[model samples]
Target chain A: MEEKNGATSKAGDWRSYERVLLPPVRDLHRLEVYEQNGGYEALREVLTSDKWDPTSVTNEVRNSGLRGRGGAGFLTGLKWTFMPPVDPNIPRFLCGNGDESEPGTFKDRQLMEFNPHLIFEGMLIASYAMSITTSYLYVRGEFADWISLMEVELAKAYEKGYVGKNVLGTDFSTDLVIHKGAGAYICGEESSLMISLEGERPYPRAKPPFPAQRGLWNYPTTINNVETLACVPLIINRGGEWFADLGSHRHPGPVLYGISGHVNRPGVYEYPTGMLITDLIYDVAKGMRGSKKLKAVVPGGSSTPILRADQIDGVTMDAETLRDAGSMMGTAGMLIMDEDTDIVSWLRRVTRFYHHESCGQCTPCREGTGWIENIVTRIDEGAGNLRDLDLLIDLCFQMEGRTVCALADAAAWPVRFTIERFRDEFEARCRPSLVPSGGVLTPALGP
Target chain B: MTDFIKDPVILMPERHPEPVFSTEELVFTAEETRQIATWVSQYPTADGAIMKVLWMAQEKFGFLPPEVIRLSAGALGMPYARAFGVATFYTQYFKSKKGRYVLDVCTCFSCQICGGYDMLHYLEEKLGAHAGETTDDGLFTIQEVECLGACGSAPMLQITNGPYVMNLTEEKIDALIDALKRDQLPFFSSVTLPQDEDDLGGNRRTDVRDTLTYSAPPVAKTLG
Candidate 1:
């Protein structure tokens, strides 16, 4: 086992790696196992150790620079601070964004499934911080097994007085409920998730109410992603400074990045902030797989713009730096694309996804996404001219910043940039493969 | 009380027992009840948001029957169609009773390339039912869904309402189905956080890459 920066990295073999990093924690979904492992020590620590003050906890988190580990890297402490100060008369809400609907992202489900107790513990601490009594984890509808696992964990937490009335003999009582979202990607968005939790179409509500001031029944609500809540336990257990020490000043703490595509090792790698994209690819991922040449990467998820191969070396794995590189780390979903990949076809595939998944609530996104898909499909299948590319770019431009939600923008940006970065590649896909295209003299539009 | 077994179990007498909505069945925690009440207040009238409430009720109980839907409508002061429209409009909203486990596979383009159909076929053979059908054992429900957004890890399937299992081969699919059949929970994949592909097929967990290690800190560690 190799250790870097006080964190373990098992790289010699898969078995060794899983053993050291993924060590099983006695199946603590049961109360007995959890208590044995010092499960609620943090809760106990927070409660009795200096009489846990909600403001203190919130202040520590704010200082630690823990950002939401969901798609958008919103500052977790800032989000916590957004909650209206403790209100006893009004019902306070803590929503767990289990609607893991972003494409290429299922880390939250894994967190809930394997270490559900961890998330439950996080919820307890968060509920403690917010002075909230009622909380709901809005899990994706399809995650029935995970929901059950969470229920079991909740029962365990309850048995140990981690939840339910008079938690850990503290007057700060909070109850956690598992709510399911009916299959909508928008539900993963905080406002939409709140709406969905209230049992409406999983669509984003206009901001300003923002779930902090008015959410989940028009009261103050604090919604954190499952991973965000999961991180809460770590923050509480180990002091905030320990978490701050893991990553850089910009984006502190360990981020579980889901690496996939043409890479030799494609899985979730939790690295601290300020890690290089080169290290993530070369050291962590062990380079590209097979004879495939590296092409571009969707640094975040499909929504993020593609980064050229040359762009990999110094690209910081944090959100702000990646945004500076012309792509937001929308979600830490690094989708690798080999040289053999056709950008035209891939873009079309993503366009089709956006079109299909469009909630139809917004017309520009609903129509523009479908239009881009049709044009891109024609281009990919050898039925398009240069005009089609211009038209596609135009459609993307229109959908970029005009929609009520970012869904449209998410679909549009990748297509626009893919065309810009690899225009010739897309154009190459245009001429029928058999049609000789002057011996593949490709052009690269300036980035 | 109803038995755990899914049979024509009698909750009522032979002739006709007035099915009473138990406090446990209809009632929720004060917080949950308040949530339901708040959702009801969203519409122009109290009855308008009744279907939304029914879906919420279904979410709480897993499935909704005509009785529950009607009860919800009555509770929310909505008409039957409005409530039924809410229940029946969304694909996730269950109308007729379904099997215990619902297997939703991504049959979209990306998954198709990665052998989604083959896996679907395998599931059909394994479950002894075609898509949109349930098995005679009444334990599994299989349906093909649009993309669940893990295109990076294609050929994915969500098992019996669990995480999306991706990077799928026949063997992995078989292992997953077997696990579900035995009522054992399967492994969870944290491929990435689904961001853009929100609604259609996002949030499904996929295959665990053999070499991929979750939770490696940013800096490489040197062991003594």
Candidate 2:
């Protein structure tokens, strides 16, 4: 609950922290407007001058403490270092994951929609860092409109020599293709995204071949989230130390907090990480709708564990604070619930989403999600028994850590956490067991 | 009724349905072929372009019938089964015929909390079609979908996988349905943050024409 003064100025104002990802530049999606506002300056500086090189760029990002904004919060610079040292004979690839399908997460969509060139610019810088010639920006199929907008902007970037072959008239060359994903949430998982790019059913592959080593046609590949890559230019421009100093020391840098549900004004707000969750729910989002008391919160996306209102009293939005508070800063898509919200029904709907979207790749995830949804549905419908609650918990244990990807874990966390945290609500809905726990039934002698 | 049952039924797609498009109509145009070629060259192998090609096919033919999927696979020179599996895996690539306007009502957690189901039920009652069913008029299809990532503007529905009509009320739904019946698609409304209203003069992006200011979510008529 300790407040970090990183985002506040001497005047103790929250608005003092400026927006880097979604800047206030008018028509920034346009290449000309972007260039006028120092859009490609980072890429230009990195490409043209001998002052910067690939390793230095990676080092700079590492120094910035920029974590992947997609969900995992892994250091972007460290991830860049994972690529097997570039071989002239071998080809390397980078996939910009724009599959922002996680529910309660819509920051990437707005970022992609408004300031596309920044993403393209970031991609160019990333390509130069990794010696990648071609990169794919994997956008979800639901974002067809955003894809079209990016396509127009990307073509404009290409025509202006900002992207495509020979970026900025230098020897360094890179190309970005906008790959549209069909409506599968699993594709947001990096390996599955690679498989989807390879024209397969988007099943996540087992790790240790880990995308950095082998991916996309079995070549060396690196996939960074869209927002993660978007921060690269700022890291390059402002110097890593400056970028690292903006947010919490551990998880520093500006983050787009997509606050939604039951708030008076729910929208994507850019703020430095480590802003108090209370400040976010109250001051930033303009408090609860209808002056209702806070009930519960899904601190990150739907996948992250839901926390009771009291649990988030002094918690900040950074990954470490949220993790310590028993929820991860997952995509920073905070779903706020008011006192009137129905926990059981909400959990049921969330379980149903996991069931519906499970790729059916692993038996645990495929079967477990369906089973979990069914149990929750029955519980929500006032069906029998306290044992079912135990069964739900048991099913979560069985599903977690048993699948190839984290999808199973993601599916289990919300169900397990919601039930564990809101047991009273769920228990109230269920009828007691017919048989006493220690009582034994007499066998029929005639039989 | 509870979804929990001893025997769960798995609905299968029709193995062989009547062809919606003729052989002549099924073929991609020369321009489309060239566009497909550009996409094909973008990838190291033709397989990588399968999704994009299938998307293009879906756009051209409306939905991916078996023959159209085959056509797409044939265009990419990949296996038909592979194309079919890819087609079936993703929900957006519709395998069957749909009404002109598919109202994908988002009833995910955030939207659900903010009357997503209420908006869905309202549409169901008004249109006389349950979720996932097309109206007899063949103009509208109501679908209860998962999140489309527009949680900020909850209780929203997308029109035929295009523009999102967000911040829904019964009146807005009525107007939307009326407009759609008259062949009007909703324009994309960029919902701005409250912070932007205070700092950036209401909107950050000046290029966007239609913008919506975020407001308090409406209370649900039914929590379910």
Chain B TM-score (each prediction, in order): 0.65, 0.91
List DockQ, one per candidate, in order: 0.12, 0.69
Please estimate how well model 1 matches the true structure, expressed as its whole-model Cα lDDT: 0.68
B1-224 per-residue lDDT for model 1 (tens digits): 56667786666656743444564576656786787676644332465345446666766766766667777777766676556645643567676557877788875543543356677887899779999998998888888876564544666777645566666667887787688778876655444322212222432223233221322111101100
User: What docking grade applies to model 2?
Assistant: medium
What alpha-carbon RMSD in Å does predicted model 1 have with respect to the real structure?
A: 11.7
Across residues A142-201, which tens digit of lDDT does each residue of candidate 1 receive? 776567667776876777788988988877788877765556666677777666555444
- Give the number of the best model, judged by TM-score: 2
List lDDT for all candidates, in order. Answer: 0.68, 0.88
True contacts kept of 2: 0.87
Q: Which ten residues in a row have the lowest lDDT in candidate 1 chain A?
A: A14-23
On a 0 to 100 scale, what is the lDDT of residue A403 in model 2?
Answer: 93
For each of the candidates, the C-alpha root-mean-square deviation to the true structure, in angstroms, is: 11.7, 4.8
The Cα RMSD in angstroms, rounded to one decimal, for candidate 2 relative to the true structure is: 4.8
Which pairs of residues clash in candidate 2, taking residues 3 or more apart in a chain or in different chains? A1-A314
